[model samples]
Target: MPAASTGRRIRIRMSARAIDEPHRVASQLELLFDLTFVVAIAAVTAQFAHDSAEGHGLAGLVPFLQVFFAIWWAWMNFTWFASAYDTDDVVYRLLTMVQMGGVLVLAAGVPAAADHSDYRAVTFGYLIMRIGLVAQWLRAGADDAASRRTALRYAAGITFVQAGWVLRLVVSETGALPPSAQVPFFAALYVLELAVPRWAERTRPTNWHPHHIAERYGLFTIILLGESVLATSRGVEGVLGAAGAGSPLVVIAVSGLVLLFALWWLYFLAPAGDGLSDRRHRSYLWGYGHYGIFAALAALGAGLEVAVEQTGHDIDASPLAICYAVAIPVGVFLMLVWMVNASLLAKPVMRPAVILGCVTVILLLPLAAPQLGVAAVVAAIAASCVLLVILTIAPWTRRLQDGCPKP
Candidate 1:
């Protein structure tokens, strides 16, 4: 059954929609669907904090990236596919629900998956998600002959990779492959998975709405930003627990809030939806570039959690390590956001000199960690945020005054 409205009629059917300018917006169902992913991202970031606290350091980052990539990729696949072919009929809703089930299962496995030695539970959930995607692809292929080739290509790629996941699980369980094999296995799978969409679209590209896809990415970015806020709140709570609401704790808390809001402001300064709607050719770069953005944002949260632990003296990880944990992700987020905005607008959104300068300051933070106090380090990070806002806000303000969109 089509989802109902008391005063509004709904038309839901498995029909091949035209590729022309479709007035697209993220639907309520899409937002509801994103909630599952929000849970998944939170779990992953929490696992990162736990693993980092356990002395995993940079060693744990590889496995964290592997799992995070899988989770992000799954969400991306479903979101883009829905952008093109979402009917919102009973079948479509049911298929989406099945994907949500897989997301929940995958999220449940995140902590254990961080171990890098465990494959059973994570593989199971990944297979479930891919199987659901395969079903969706087949449905789209059958429903839309114009896009049948692209849809079937997606189905074939998903099925093949899912088989590989199952094989790895079976091999590890049977002791035919050692637990150490997951690293290489995961790398190969990531490469293969990324190539599939590019290859599929070469011949028969699906006419997904550019603005809708851009908005979906923006919304997911907001979800990750919420995780950052959650991490910041946790940091404040830890500070309050250990040192009460002292001046230092208050300063740290305020710094975290400033950094969060600055990062949010920086991201929204680019008119991503308008730009993407204009230059469809850059969609691949804009889409692929966000993997780093999403991962960096999530890791930024995990890094803050580590900072909190350090501030509370809960872990003996070096001040340098703590600062690097937070700083590196922030730098990566800044770089990728710049690159994505540049691609979208076909011009630099910020002066290269200014971007290079702020990024260098962020990158140099961990080095200053050895001499600086924890509060000073956090404050420095917040200072960099202030600089970013100062540098980027002017162009946006000028554009607005000129009645032009900020790029």
Candidate 2:
């Protein structure tokens, strides 16, 4: 029941989407699905920012990682699965909507998750999403002969890991698993969840479209970058509310936007579509590597919020710590994006020395906060990002002027 064209009418029966489908852009339904995740990511980032603002930045990392893993994993799983087998039927659309509702449920649990280490609501919401995805997999197994075993494996693996998650929640709630002990438990289940797709696709890989995959990732990247925009707007609001337009917070906000824009610019430079199309076997690593990338971008938003709050005397964190909060994520985002892009492309767009040098500069910039003030330091960090963009882009521009095509 595979469809040759992506824009075909909705089908009553389930089907596989063509692997080489031309111009196979993401559908409106998929965009709607992403909105729920925006809510979920915002909730998690806000909770983390609140913690960081209260000077609990390090201690807050645990719950942040846990909740963000659930959010990112659920989104990734559906994305790849839909790439392979989006039936676009009424039932399929409805099931996807159910996952959206689950994201809201998960979003509603962020505070309890971060403040109290309670995950009952979080687990319940994950269960809802897991149910929707599992049903999709079961249908895939029944309807698509070529990928039936793979689909069944995915369904079974997801079910097994999800049940483990529920059980972990139960034991934790019952005091059998203490808060201190929950980390290892969560780590164990997380490993299993990450392993599911690898184990499932061992024999029969799904016919996912490479260009479509790239486009989907680009859309999600924009969505994550929007967090930084929203976070910066909050900073701007605080500055205007407290010290009016002349406040130094305005500089921080402007610098933060520049830094985010540079990152977005850097991410799109790699020709991911061609690379993934040629090296499909490496898709697992390319996809898995993004965990760090996405996490860093979202964390950068929280760090930016923390930066703004610190300037306004709202957060109790040390000036240096707040500076590092911004610097560290910028460095990580730079390094991980470079690394992930290297794995995807034959030759990375940016040189290794340039990447290392920029990261080193970004990370060390925070140490000067006491002397130059946090605003100046953040502005310098943003300038470094702009420098990196220049370093990576100037060569392409020169090549184009020399009558050579830019890669």
TM-score of each: 0.92, 0.96
Please provide, for model 1 over 1-407, each residue's C-alpha lDDT reduced to its tens digit, 9 standing for 90 to 100.
23363114232434454435466788777898899988888888988877776677677788678778988999999988888777776667777788888888888888776775575777777778888789888887887777788888999988887887788778877889776776798779788888989988886877778778878988998999899889867867876788666655566667777887888888887768778778878888988899999999999898887776566556757778777777888888888998888887867677778877888998787787778766678779878978888977888789899999865
Candidate 2: regions farther than 4 A off: 1-11
Candidate 2 scores a C-alpha RMSD against the true structure in Å of: 2.0
lDDT of 2 by residue, 282-350 (tens): 888888888888888888999898787666665678778888889988888888888878887877899
Candidate 2 yields a Cα-based lDDT of: 0.88
- Top lDDT prediction, candidate number: 2
- The TM-score of candidate 2 is 0.96
lDDT of each: 0.80, 0.88
The residue pairs that clash in candidate 2, if any, are: none
